[model samples]
Target: MENIRIFVQKHKKVSWLVLIGYLIFCGCFVFPLSNERWSFDFEKAYMIILSYGILATLFTSLLSSNKSIHVYSISLLCTTVGMILRYIIEYGEYSNTINFTQINIIMYLGIIPVFCTLIYWIICKLESITCK
Candidate 1:
């Protein structure tokens, strides 16, 4: 508990970014989007996304620590792999006809990591600004 609090305090910006990014991602589910429904392999895709999200959150929490960058890198890698897997699955199953739709959905999932990367970039920029 103490360590977690210290981590949070030390990496306040990153922590807030993670929280906000997660909220935004979750909020996207509420709207009645056309491709919101699950398809044949919905369970697998959902599981992958859930796992990726958890890993990303954990990575963000531990990012400020000097122990290892493995966790953060793995989290990002998992997200990329999951997105690719989603695209491949959709493409293989549906071919060109469904490719566009699958691409859009996969793009939505891709945004998760992009936001995380952006958050890190923003934090770095802020740090540079503070130092200057």
Candidate 2:
């Protein structure tokens, strides 16, 4: 644990990028630049799956040491793998909608994080206000 913390502190830039990568993962992935390289409808369900992953990461972060990047790295990797496996198994129905021609950028990135952050804020508030 101490070793992990030390590593992140020593490599501040990489750690910060990794942290931001986690926070913005869903936004970047879903807000498609071009429709050809992606299937909007088939892939949209990942927003749900990865949002939960973000939720798990956020709560777990509250428990990290001062250097939280270690936890974030592990959590990010695990959550990504977990989501992929889930998609493999659950890709039946959503796949049919792959022909989607458009997506709302604001709507796609706006909704879920707002809710997730609110829930995270509540948990942090609760923890700090909890009695010793």
Candidate 3:
């Protein structure tokens, strides 16, 4: 369909970034952190993180479009909300203290925003290129 083609063209970079970010989060954060003691079931934590990552990627893909910034933004927002919910459900329920290891802090605060900014920049670049 023409719509699908246009959507891909507009959000290819965002899609790629989301994929890479998800991979990085899984490889760099989840895998290593799973070994740490948090007084929770590791399998459950891993599943929740994995599910959030998959949902983020899926939403990003579904909302891809040149003329739908609102939709894309909503998808991103949902992804963020899902991530926060996962964090709360996993740790908050048990009153587990959040550890601020260098890697964890960077992944949570730095990498998330970097991923978002990259997607936004790529969207702007794609729009300008298509306009010209």
Candidate 4:
């Protein structure tokens, strides 16, 4: 508890970025799953984003290193390995669709990360320039 409070104080900008990013990021998946009764491997996304966001935020904040990388890249290299482990557990929710494996793998492993990392990288760049 004390450590968390201290961490929060030290990484205020990064913390807020993580919370907002997670909400927006997770909301995209959560909204469809809850409202429309449709989702595309929501579990994989939720797991990856949540874990990556938290772990990156904590680790980077601890080191007082790059907030841009922590918040925007959103834990870059941690992604691929985590996706593999998560794929084994939370995959196949969309297995009924055509080319499901190729599509989801491309999505979960390729496009999604690229898109997410790009978004955060841009935001981090802007924040670095504007905020600092």
Candidate 5:
């Protein structure tokens, strides 16, 4: 916990760049167009990204404490922006309207700290590995 905070604070600029870049570059993956209908399944897309993000967060965090926060934030922000952009792009192609709600905004904002904490804990585990 303390180490992650110290790391983040020490590398504030890099952290900010990492977050911004993650948010922007998430959608760079190529997707197959054969199952066009699957593109509309925003729910499935969100679940897939979140699931993978969590797993990645776990692995990366476990590998290096100083690296966990960066990895977690990158994964979370990337998946989030990727999913939202995918939804917007798909819906826009068909001229469909996507609804936004206050609850959604609140939910996203609420999860930020929770995810950060999860990442922090994973990073904290590094103490055990490095202390020896």
Candidate 6:
């Protein structure tokens, strides 16, 4: 808890950038999805955005040093929060009731750390290859 607080304090600017970037990225997709004339499939767009976010976070996590796990975690948090906010803004107008079920919330929030772990594995592979 204290560590997380300190980490946020130390990397405020980077964290903010990640949050805003995620929001904008998600918004781009949301706008098209919201259009009734576009014939856009909601599930497809959602999965695309989810994969894109995972890839984006993976790359960002790769850029962090081994000691910077907190940085990676913070970035992941920002990405998840931005995504939720985008969903809220885009869908809130249509639905009077929004039920945030535990499973739905977990699935939404869990993608970050999953990709972060993948990033760590990738980084390890790279380091091993380069060190040889």
Superposed on all Cα atoms, the candidates' RMSDs to the truth, in angstroms, are 9.9, 10.5, 9.4, 8.5, 8.6, 8.8
Q: Which tens-of-lDDT digit does each residue in 23-116 have in candidate 5?
A: 4444323222113234436665665357444444443433455565565566566656754675666665552222233443344434543455
What C-alpha lDDT do the candidate models reach, one value each? 0.49, 0.47, 0.49, 0.48, 0.49, 0.51
Query: Mind giving the per-residue lDDT tens digits that candidate 3 earns over 1-132?
Result: 346446755887886566546644443344223225654486856674555445443444545444245534543444455455555556645423444345654454444444544454455466568779
What TM-score number comes out for model 1?
Answer: 0.35
Off by over 4 Å in 6: 1-20, 23-64, 87-99
Which tens-of-lDDT digit does each residue in 39-118 have in candidate 2?
Answer: 44645666565664555444435444232344445444543443344445446665324422235333433444444545
Model 5, global lDDT: 0.49
Residue 109 in candidate 6 has what lDDT?
51
Residues 93-127 of candidate 1 have per-residue lDDT tens digits of 64424434656556644555555455444554554
Compute each candidate's TM-score over C-alphas.
0.35, 0.38, 0.35, 0.37, 0.38, 0.46
Query: Model 4 compared with the native: what TM-score?
Result: 0.37
Q: Which stretches of candidate 3 lie over 4 Å from their true place?
A: 1-83, 92-102
lDDT of 5 at 9: 67
User: For model 6, how does the per-residue alpha-carbon lDDT over 9-73 read when each residue is reduced to its tens digit?
Assistant: 57868755654575446433333332333354868666655655554443444344453465456
Clashing pairs for predicted structure model 5, backbone only:
none
Model 5 quality (TM-score): 0.38
The residue-by-residue lDDT of candidate 4 on 23-51, one tens digit each, is 44443332222212345586866776665
lDDT of 2: 0.47
| Best of the candidates, TM-score | 6
